[model samples]
Target: MTLPIDPTALAGLVSRQIRTGERQGMPTKIAIAERTYATDPDDLWNALTDAGRIPRWFLPISGDLSVGGRYQLEGNAGGVVEECEPPKRFAVTWEMGPMISWLEVRLDPAAEGTTLELVHEAPVDPDMWKQFGPGAVGVGWDLGLMGLGLHLDSGAAVDPATALEFPTSPEGMMFVRTAATGWADAAIADGDDPALARPAAEATLAFYTVIPEEGTQS
Candidate 1:
């Protein structure tokens, strides 16, 4: 279904940035992006931390959330909460089966409201990185941020089925295109060759917005 959202205004609500850094003994890189929300740090923190509120915007999350605890997202990754600093920052291990990644989030109070920055680091799989660049993970975060914005604005639970089906929808493709282009810009800013990164952005966009074949799920 097509959502009633302004592609232009929606595009203006957030920004994307990317940077790469090394890790110990692994061929890996990290991507960090920040999105500013028109809300206080405490409110944004609550939205991110409160289990009751999480499923409204992001996914239905369970398990312990304190430092040294484990948390799981319904139908998604579950990991150890490595650090927690209330309304400012949190760090966790994002694990799905044998694959492992690290995710960190920081909130900074700003004139516009609160700036939420997410850092996701994963061991680079040469082939996958070549296929999608930063947008592989960047675009996923973009969708989560969009859902957070919607929930913050309306305080309504998003329909999961609808959210899943969105990317293949017409207006949804427009939003996806905007997100993909933003990531291309970010990659270029990080010194990636545009010849490679731009096409990776397109690959990422196509991956996110393409229709699934009959009887197969996205």
Candidate 2:
């Protein structure tokens, strides 16, 4: 299945690569994505901070959501809440086995809506990032934002799996295909070698294929 690509949407968001020194001579690198929603910052904050709303779009998150509080995601990763500022910003440790990363989300108000920014930093194996590229998190976040849009605009509860599955539908495939191309473009813009970006995009598309194009595979 190929998905339609929204180059403008992908390009509008800001993504940064961070390098942190904590592992001997190796450097930790991360990529961030930022976007604005047509909703108030407070509303956006509730959607993220409210545990009940999390599973509707993103993962099933369980945590105190306060500074220094620990949290967990069902069947996924878990870690400690590093920082929290209601209606503004929050940070947490994202742990999956040996990989420990930090994810920070910030919210701000705008004339049209609310601005949402996400930053994820960790010591990634260079080869892994080369294979996954931005789509590793980009696709997931896209689904999350789509759900947020539904909730804010129409009070709809989007099934997380369905949101992810949409990209495999005949129409959805077009979106995924286009999205893959967009990710490739973003990677290139972020200074990834063309040679690396193309393959990385391909790998990301392949990862999504774990669910069959017909939406039967789990």
Best by TM-score: 1
Each prediction's Cα lDDT score? 0.85, 0.69
Give the per-residue lDDT digits (tens) of candidate 2, residues 58-146: 67888676778888888788999888889899998889988787788989898889988887767757777788877776665655565
Over 4 Å off, model 2: 1-25, 213-217
Alpha-carbon RMSD, candidate 2: 3.9
lDDT of 1 by residue, 1-218 (tens): 23446754685566777777777777667777788989999999999999899999889899999899999999999999999999999999999999999999999999999999998989888788778988888888878888888788777877788888878888778888888888888878978888998899899999998888999965
Candidate 1 total steric clashes: 0
Kindly give the stretch of ten consecutive residues in candidate 1 with the minimal lDDT sum.
1-10
Using alpha carbons, what is the TM-score of model 2? 0.81
lDDT at residue 107 of model 1 (Cα atoms): 100
Candidate 2 total steric clashes: 11
